[model samples]
Target chain A: MRTEEQANQAVEEYADLVRRLCFMRLKNREDSEDVFQTVFLKYLLYDGTFESAEHEKAWFIRITINSCKDSLRSVFRRRTLPLEVLSEEAAAVPEEHGALLEAVLSLPDHYKDAIYLFYYEGYSAVEIAEILGRKENTVYTWLSRGRALLRRRLGGDCL
Target chain B: MNQLQEALRGVAATQELKEWTRRRLVRERTRRRSAGRKGLAAAVCACLLCLLLGAGGYRFYMSPVSYISIDVNPSLELGLNAFDRVVQTVAYNDGGDEIAARLSLQNMPYQQAVDEVLSDQVFQSYAAQGNGVVFTVVSGDGARLQAGLEGCSGYYASGGHSYLADARCLDEAHTNGLSVGKYRAYLELSEYDPSVTVDDCHHMSMGELQQRLEQCHEGAQSTQGHGHGEHRHGHS
Candidate 1:
């Protein structure tokens, strides 16, 4: 039974990570916004007790990714905006790292997601596979391919 | 692209969705709390029902609703737990403990239970004085146990709720082939005679009473050793 204060603290801590993960998966603001609300709502109502804070954090990450995937497969999935238009048109990244965000966003969908989780979230290939519900070898292949793509965009061995 | 980490980390949940999620969470928590309360109440009710049933069963098991009380030198009461089971066979007097040990009547049915008790060698020892056994049978159900006592009815009459019936009557009735009930009814209406000792007449039947009168005449003619007039005096 999480108290209101505890739920608020959780929202404060994980909201950004979940929001960015949603944006990465959806690549469109409207769909991302739907998943953002959905994931946090799920967190607040989770019946199981977590063993530790890390376990709780991992659970939130897994649910956010799964919720994004579910929204993509939902009945409302057909009504979609252009992924290219959103990436080029949405320039909400801060001035300090505008170029990097734009480059990361420009990578292929699978490659970009794998790269984001591996680099930014500090997850190993095995852990990313578990969260994404993919095979470990597949996650490793995605990371390898994604890093090669990011190297081309960075004009250096970014790995 | 290390700055990409900073860029992504700085991203926040939109203000509208945060408010919506919080409001929905509050509503969900309230619903869950109510369901939990209902479950707790149901569990409490079930426990109370179990306890109520348990107490009722215990009360029914312990109550002494029906039994046969046989009182002799050491008066005793045999309690029935069920229709065919003797749950408690205890003595009510001081010598009761000693007499009760000889009784192999526990768990026996009503018909055979009494006969088994009376036949106990130790019980017979206690009744050597012929302080005839007293029997009082009772049942809450409208069942009268007087009939169908079989071979025992001849020796033991349908005594009052409690009656002192001579033990010797059992032997006498056995010898004369008489039912104890018919014999006692006859004795109640017979005349006393000097030939029969007063002690034996305590339970002597009326048929036996007539025999005593005939013996009185025979003794006067036959026995000159004791004066016939003195024998008559003794009888009087």
Candidate 2:
């Protein structure tokens, strides 16, 4: 059981871990915020107890993904927008980087999340699988598929 | 190296997460304390009264006030100052590092108002998002005022300049010249009651404090009157 002080510290130290996980899974900035809040509030209320930092990090990832799933379920009834390009307004993309972000956003949610976590966050495929509650092969498949999709969308030989 | 990574380098998480976390922790502490008490009859009355006021078109529960606070994680503090601009999901600290945020809301009916602010597209586009906030409704006089760091209740703020701090909800104590403190009844999750007994307990001149209380009461009551005025044809 983590003490209040340690719990506070844990939240502070690994907040980015939480953000990265949410960013990968949800794609949209707004839904990501909703999931992020739900994750921390749950951590504070019931799941603050963790045996190790790794344990806490894994827990945050799992909860964040689940929260995204919950939001996805809710979106069945409520009109939902893609997380990458918000429907409320046009994203102000500079002429240079807009195409690249749009390509990343076009991938399936699972593929997009896996690719970002693996390449950007430097998580091993095994670790990504563990956080995502999937097998190693699944993570590999997502990464491969996501990269192919990004390559195709960007129409570049870079892989 | 990847496009996503390149995008993220320029995509900044906002700085307001610190404020959200601070407010959340304090509100969490307050809610836990309130639930420990047994007498919730008055609280139920207050909720009913507010609901009736809303029904009558008083708009008592739809106040636009919001409370915000920032807390820097020692580890994340270094990177906070790098953020370029403020977005709904992003805020930049003074030192220029970025961190995620969490929010604690003391009022439930006002979630719509808060959602309006949080859901803005400019605010929503950033990837560095804060955790979901806990919203609880408490009754009180002041809306947004700087609170002392320790207690979760509202104190008798004397001057005009209240810091732009995370304001807790205060309850009106009808007896003892309307005691100033956090309202206990409106919490879902809490750490402790936000009520604190001041040292100069006797310093509260009943007349002066009562006048203040009456002003607040009249304000709420006047709002209630307006709400009822809206429903005059419906009820009759």
Candidate 3:
């Protein structure tokens, strides 16, 4: 079991990782916060131990994915948050890129998951397959399908 | 190339949780540690006491006693371990009539076991005395009492179906509603003896209640057997 101080330090160091995991799935700030707390509470209660930073990151990713899936299953109520709800940083980005990211979120959950893991986290297809409990070929198919859908939705500008 | 990543970086890095949540987790962790330490200390003290008692070799005297009635539904009674006290009296409502029933659940394990059983038809049918039923478990402050009834409804619905499925009808009797009999039970969880008291408010006989409970239990066993054989896998 990690000491409380060590756990808190780990949370602080990986705050951004946790935040991105939540943002990528939930697409809302408040819901992500709830998932984040639940994940840490679970980590503390279960005495989750890791050998290294990569192990910790992988565990956190798995937990985040499970949390998001659970949220989707249990909380079916739609949150009416708008697409332009990002910070001034995202607002400062080119409109075309922003639109592309929005289109990515609109994809089906499997494709969205594959695309996010591929581009955002920079996981290889095989790693995505292992992480998602799917075959490598399935991951490749989803990535290709997701990219094609995005290109189609974003038109010629996506290329 | 990295501009998209940078834009995604800080914007995604919002303060994820409230300060209170962190404080709550810390407090809970500390409390759990302190509680664990206290439990360890208590265990050591108990061992020391036992050692001293053994050195003295003075055997603790015991008494022999018999209970007045072997209450099939003990949760309805009030008293000590023997369930000889009446903590409170209650009259439950079922349909249009007020039936005389009592609630009592003393032994928590018995209550828990009975509740688990009742949550399935097999166990619940056994607890029924005539039209009245007994509740074995009473959780703190009647919280378990409320949940217990809802659990019974689900149990009954499933039990009804399974019971029908097994019966060899002339043409597999297409009866739509058989287990619709309203069950009126008295539930009580006291500081002493906590058990459920079920009287036949519906005037159901001892034989009918037993059969129902037995059939349900049989169905539950078969269902459990089925669940075990088919699916034993979980996410890796």
Q: Which candidate is the best by TM-score?
A: 3
Higher-lDDT candidate among 2 and 3?
3
| Error in Å for residue B66 of model 2 | 33
Question: How much is B137 displaced in model 1, in angstroms?
Answer: 73
DockQ of 2: 0.05
- Find the candidate with the highest DockQ and give its number: 1
Off by over 4 Å in 2: A1-4, A25-30, A80-95, A157-159, B1-3, B36-236
Worst 10 residues of 3 chain B by lDDT: B184-193
Q: Spell out the clash pairs found in candidate 1.
A: B187-B206
State fnat for each of the candidate structures.
0.29, 0.10, 0.12
Off by over 4 Å in 3: A77-96, A156-159, B2-7, B15-21, B35-236
Model 2 chain A worst lDDT window (10 residues): A83-92
The weakest ten consecutive residues by lDDT in model 3 chain A span A72-81
Task: Judge candidate 1 against the unseen true structure and give its global Cα lDDT, from 0 to 1.
Answer: 0.56
Residue A151 accuracy (lDDT) in model 1: 77
TM-score list, all predictions: 0.44, 0.44, 0.46
All predictions: root-mean-square deviation over Cα? 43.4, 23.7, 18.6
Clashes of each: 1, 39, 28
lDDT (CA) for every model shown?
A: 0.56, 0.42, 0.44
Q: iRMSD (Å) of candidate 1?
A: 42.7
Tens-digit per-residue lDDT, B1-236, candidate 3? 44336436544444435354466568867976797688678757755775788843222111101111111222221111212122222221231111113223333322342343345443344434332342222222122222223223332222111100112221111132111121211110110112322333234432354345434433433343333432111101
